[model samples]
Target: MNISWEEIELYLRHTFVTARESKKNVKRVIVKLEDDGFYGLGEAAPSPRYSESVETVKNFLNEFNKLISENMSLYTTLQMLNNLNGNYSAKSAVDIALYDLHTKKLNLPLWQYFGLTSDKIINTSFTIGIDTTENIERKLDEAHEFKVLKIKLGCEDDIKIIQTIRRYTDKPLRIDVNEGWKNLNKAIELIKYLEDNNIELIEQPLPSEMLYENNRLREQTTIPIFADENCKTFEDLILVKDYFDGINIKLSKCGGIFNAYLMIQVARYLNLKIMLGCMIESSIGISAAAQLASMVDYIDLDGNLLINNDPYTGVICKEGELKLINEPGIGVMKIEK
Candidate 1:
């Protein structure tokens, strides 16, 4: 096997805002692996929240290339990734590409490779990033095709943001605080206030390190509290199950499909709801994540949908439902940008 990668910037349709920061564009690295007339592709959309950047992803890929052998098997590659210290997002690219290439060799789609039926796939939630009341309305209008909306909260006027959204549409709402709410009492109060507003769930309301505070908040709220930043690997699931009602598993954060598949099995055994989420990515990343959609309880693979300049075509979202192509591997095809 051989590996090569390049960095590209993805522009958002609107300025993407979360509790932590705002961005109009995000940088990502596209990795390609080829062997004897077969080719596979992957993406690394590293998040600053996880201490990863384009430079870090590229550095890891360079080291991985030196370590990977041409005749390495898929399982061997995965084991090598497992032994790697950190850089889960960087490992994810190799994992995704290996899966894509291997599954294609087997002439199987990734979902079929997992023994999952296509009908088991569910609708993915479209995200509405934090903005002014006016911009929020505009964002809602743009997201009209999606049946469910995930709103970004954590500002001073958290309740007001929901209220503002409510005034425009009655669509089912899910809120992600992105670890913005710090005060346990205030978080409890906010969840209590949102109980009647048709909220489906709340994500990472408190800080990531505040496990006890999150557990306390969960004990007091009717809405399911999901762990995002706090839950990364299979081990975190065991710990977070005691605090959170669910976990948001990201392929990049968890080191891609191999790791995420293991995490899903453990999450189900722990009786924790699974929400497959994504960073701001292109179709390659989104499609790779969508392959596991049938196994998760909820889907948030709208990272590709939020982007205006996606260089590849893979899984597509139609009215909130991710439509996976019947083609082999992760079903991604690069197009002229």
Candidate 2:
């Protein structure tokens, strides 16, 4: 097998601002694995909050290449990769590549290989990043095919943002605060207000450290609260199960598909809802996440949809629904530049 990676710039269609940072262009690392005249692709979109960068991912991949030799079994390769701590995004790139390679070798679509039925897949929400009301309206117009919208909030004008979007469309809304809110009382009040406005869910309202506050908020409100920053690994699930109604599993945060699969099972065992999400990535990454869509109650794999320049062709998003092809592996092809 041969391994290599390169950095690519992902240009967002609009300025995307969270409480943490604002981004117009994000840097991602694309990893490629090749063996026996077949190629598998993966992506690593690192987050600063997670302390992962292109440099770190590249270094980890370099070390990973040194540890593996020819004819290694996929299970052993995955186990060896799992043993290396941190760099979840890096691990995700490798994990996805391996899955793509393995599934292609078996000539089965990833979802089918995982025993998931196509009808079980749900609609994905298009994101409306933090922006002016005028820009928000434009973004909404651009997202006409999306029946669900995920809004970025946590600013002083958060309520106004919801009100502005309400005037345009009645689509079910999901709000992500990115750990922006600090006050529990205010968070509860805001959540109630959002619920009244047809908001389906609220994500990461408070910082990860405020587990007690999150639990109190969850108890006080009827709306489902999802843990984003609060839940990174499987162990964090125990701390959040009492507080959050569900967990948003990002491959970058949990190390990749292998761990993400485990996280979904554990969440199901605990009777918690599951949402598969992604960072600002290309089609390669989004396609990888989409493979696990049928296992979750909700899908937020619209990262690639929000971007203008996606260098790969993978999942098909139409009429707010996510559709996967019957092609083998992750079922994505590179778009010629």
Candidate 3:
């Protein structure tokens, strides 16, 4: 068995700003696993908020290589991953590669291997990052195929941002505050105003640590609230299940497909709506996230779509719809330079 990784730069089509930071270029690590003349690919888009960076992911993978033995079963591999604390992005890269390798060996696309109907996949929302009204309109012009839009809020001009977007298209809107709002009363009032518009859902209106405030806001607002920063692993779900109507599951946040599958099952058991999401990454990472799209109520796998240079291709996003091609093992192919 052989394991290696490379750092790559991903430039967003537009400036991506949240309450935390502004991002123009994102650095990611691409992991490749090779054995018996076959190779599996994975990617890790580390988030600083989680204390993960390209350097951390690379170091973690180096340590992970020492744990690999000959012909290791997937179950044992996952157990090994669980033993390691933190570095969810690193674990996700390895987990995705193992699954990709397993599915390829079986000659089945990931969706088919999971017994998921491709048609069950829903439309993915294109995101409009925080920016000026003119920039927002220009971004919308570029997003012709996307019928649904996810807008970033939590600024002083939150209302103006929604109003600006509404002036152009009546498309369904979703808002992610990224733990931006601090006041519960003000959050509820803004949520009500957004509900009166065409907003479909609101995500993480308050700080993640404000569990009581989030629960209160959930009880007061008429719109559905999805938890992003508040919910990471299944344990976090236990704490937030009563507060949030749904959860946004990112492979990086949950560790990988193995845990993400379990998260979906637990979310279902709790009767919570599921949303599959991703960070700014190339097709390799977005495609891995898309493999689970059939199991979720909504998807935001357009991270690859917002990039100019995607080094891999797998899932195709056409006019807001996600389509998986007939290929084995996550159905991803590396583009030859």
lDDT string for model 3 (195-281, tens) is 778878898889988988888887876789999998988788887788899999999998988899999999999989999999998
Candidate 2 stretches with Cα past 4 Å from truth are none
**lDDT per residue (tens digit) for residues 1-337 in model 1:** 8899999999999998999999999999999989878889999989888899999999999899899888999999899888998898999998999999999888899999999877764788999988999999998888888998999999898988999998998988989999999898998898999999998889999898899888888888789889999998777887888998899999999999999999999899999999999999999999999999888889999998888889999997777788889999999998975
Count of clashes in candidate 2:
0
List the candidates' TM-scores in order: 0.98, 0.98, 0.98
Model 3: CA > 4 A from native: none
**lDDT-superior candidate, 1 or 2:** 1
Please say which candidate is ahead in lDDT: 2 or 3: 2
Question: Could you arrange the candidates by lDDT from highest to lowest?
Answer: 1, 2, 3
Q: Which candidate number would show the highest lDDT if scored against the true structure?
A: 1
